[model samples]
Target: MEAEDGKLKCNCPSGTFGEDCSLGVCEIENPCLNGGTCVPASNIADTPSCICPPGTFQPVCEQCYYNFTRDAYIQLDSQVMLAINSLNQTQCDEECDKDERCTFNFIGLDGCYIFEKPVIFASGNGDLNKYKERCMQMEECLLLTHILEDNKCFLFNVTLNNALSILRLIEGQHGNNIAEKICC
Candidate 1:
């Protein structure tokens, strides 16, 4: 724009607003979604960003990392279970490598339990409700798989590499059921 004094005037840039363009741009063209909060950029040269709500992520908060149901049992593939004793960590790892179905293992004080579950093991115990309660108290616990016959509960922390596996576990079918944590 041309000012009355013949000087050039211009509008605020992409991520700036207000009279002097000092305010960060957010409300004008908010990029956030799924209830995410828009955080304007510090400088006019930079673009605004979004702060995703719980259970959601990505630049626009369009993706979700948590399941919608809490403590809900999910069916998984027919997994082969093995119970062994006195196996060290290296031996347990070797055992898991031997079988394509063996995805993870739980090493207890007394023995090791191997299964084809997808999520990584954080901790496990014979008491189902006890570990389930402990998983609730933990901030990183995203999924829990329980073996009904053995009365074992295993806690898992979800990550990008394992999120798809966890989702597949939800869609699988078998006798055993896994519990997924719901963030939203």
Candidate 2:
């Protein structure tokens, strides 16, 4: 306690509170969630704040994060796949896993696999023209996918020139449509 204006006032240390600094701020109940750490407020009247971990946010860390189980992966459709001739699933997996630049292996639902660097830029609900205009604004965007059912756009930095080297388009096949960046 320190004397201020002829009256003694209680001053608590870090993380401690109450009349004599005898109680802990986090002693009663912790409010932080999703691996977040609770930090006691400097003033006794103020509430504690939470330090959220990676892939989590908000006051108590209650937010949507990619919470996938171990060994889980998302399967890509044919439109985004790069055709590697004469290579089976095992061979494709081995080749992609060995390549240092190929961090993500996009295994197609039809048993095909892509070796391209899957650097996704943006994804949101929009029409084809809207996605194309948005992609054109970004110099790095090289590919775009617009899902008709959900009206979702997925922009990527994968080059068409690079994709053309390995991909062989199957004529008349239908699913998702991929738009490549065209030069003037």
Candidate 3:
């Protein structure tokens, strides 16, 4: 907190500034929630406001997001993923191990949600939860399924640019190799 011109000011997050910080950064023409920072973008392809802080997940950051497992690996925030946050990190880990469908685990918030398979769009709210869990047996780029999905969930060393091109080739285009190619 800080004071300016004899007025009290709270240390607000990105995209917000005011007395108590109660007012939404984009409350007027735009809006952001769950502590998701708002960034004004001139590009039409981008959104007016959407950051979805660690605890919160969603383009709008309205849901609590957490996920904790093991082996802590690198993950890109921009990629579409299913994430959730929970106050109980242990619960997150337990869920990951107990679920037989789990294909991969991600660490975030306090609890992590495991996927039966490498996954897609999933988010939770940070505003309502706190992260407190950890991962125990996470594998780094252990599975090649991420590459097949083209879901933008691969490690830096696992660039599949050429692989995609090869697999995407139409039948009879790449000859023998094309016939054996697999895609998901």
Candidate 4:
């Protein structure tokens, strides 16, 4: 074939296309894996190279092969617990869910960790209803403490002591009165 300006025109070979008939079209026979795109090689006619993204590795760039899994750590104030075991996020969650004692949680590049929440249940209280009630009450107390501390109360340090004293006094005065004073 010839162009209007008399330049020679050539059809791209099967599975190839471009101005110079130099780019190879990706086909089932030459599939790209790991989500890579076919890019034309600098000097290779009708041939292309697969470009894979980070964290993914494969010959054709069709299947994603992650080099790393999710990491997790427990953050308590200034303390940071390092990764327990290397695993993906789903595995981390599964491990945490399998443990009943675990509470709050977060995921990171290393894995996942169970945040240390204060245990509200006293010894021997394994009943679900009792546990729920205790957790709710403890949450309220913690919230009150946080509020008082935020307000910069000078006696905030003694709040627990004061509460204990009040409970003792109520118990001494009347057994029924103690039950009434506690939040339902």
Candidate 5:
């Protein structure tokens, strides 16, 4: 039959045939190699062509070139961030290993950043209970000051003794001064 362009149509003699004889029927052995995708040609023939994705390049899409490694991570600021512009996992690992300060690597959308050091806290000395108690007491005292001064407590970093002295001074000024200020 005559095709839309008035060309004579026939089953592809090349062992590939489809609408208007325009389909690529690669051999069962897969003529397109190296991860190449075979697509039917637009022409009135059963021939197919290969289209390769990134990190791969070949006429038959059978081979991957160097420098196309996957994603990887690096350490940064006591955190494991991902490396930038890493193509494959192998490349990413290699890059991270090259840095002495790097402790760990992580892969993410934004690539990697190297952590120079890990975070540390004094609580490692098994004094966590004491530290927690001190912090809680400090917070409670701060809250008490806020309550006694109404919601407008002036910020200060007074020592515990100094804070008590201030409280005494306020108490001496007037019996109900603290309560009046707080309620108002």
Candidate 6:
């Protein structure tokens, strides 16, 4: 839900309750349709209000603002694709979308940047102050596809790769073996 003053607007369906619209409604998770907050179902108040953004209506954040993460940082050390020239949050997402090694990473100097992946350790204050980060627009495009494993090159649903696969796993010392499973 679009949490403003923590006052949620439960947009529960016809016969439902709670901040999230899940209780009476078994349709979806959280039940807070359209990014609404599921209010706690009470004898007094029944129905979840979907706290949508200003321009959005109920049921979902349909016309509302796009969702993004904030205060994110890569853990431990940075496997940084270094020397990005002045990047903005949009560019950060764009970069993450393009990179294969980047599970998720973001610049720490801006308002908020977000990338989604597993968790890693955050950098220390001393390390954080060492370098400068910028978000200026630049002209660059990087497409990387390499053999990460013996016979496996990850190439499905890459953020910017247009759902295409690149490279074929050739023979290896361990005798190249290719088994296709759900993208792990």
Comparing 3 and 6 by lDDT, which wins?
3
User: TM-score for all predictions?
Assistant: 0.38, 0.31, 0.22, 0.23, 0.22, 0.20
Number of backbone-clashing residue pairs for each candidate, in the order shown: 0, 0, 33, 16, 20, 32
Over 1-184, each residue of candidate 5 has an lDDT whose tens digit, in order, gives: 5565777677455655566554446544355765677776665254567786654434555332112111211111223233466446566567768977555444444454333233111111223234323323232211112111222112123333443443332322211111111100
- Candidate lDDT values, in order: 0.60, 0.56, 0.38, 0.36, 0.37, 0.34
The candidate 6 region of ten consecutive residues with least summed lDDT is 132-141
lDDT of 2 at 57: 51
TM-score, candidate 4, is: 0.23
Give one digit per residue, the lDDT tens place, for model 1 in 24-87.
6576677788888988666655777888876565466664333333333443333434678999
Clashes of 2: 0
Q: State the RMSD for candidate 5.
A: 27.1
Model 3 spans with C-alpha error above 4 angstroms: 1-81, 119-184
Candidate 3, run of 10 with poorest lDDT: 128-137
Residue-wise C-alpha lDDT for candidate 3, range 1-184, written one tens digit per residue: 8778987769876544456665443664455675677766555334475776665544555543123222222233323233567635576667667766544565655456555433221234221111111110121221222211122232211223433432232232211111111111
- Give the winner by lDDT: 1 or 2: 1
Candidates, ranked, TM-score:
1, 2, 4, 3, 5, 6
Q: Which prediction has the highest TM-score against the true structure?
A: 1
lDDT of 2 by residue, 74-100 (tens): 234554445566666687778777766
Model 2 stretches with alpha carbons more than 4 Å out? 1-117, 164-175
Write down the TM-score for model 5.
Answer: 0.22
The lDDT leader among the candidates is 1
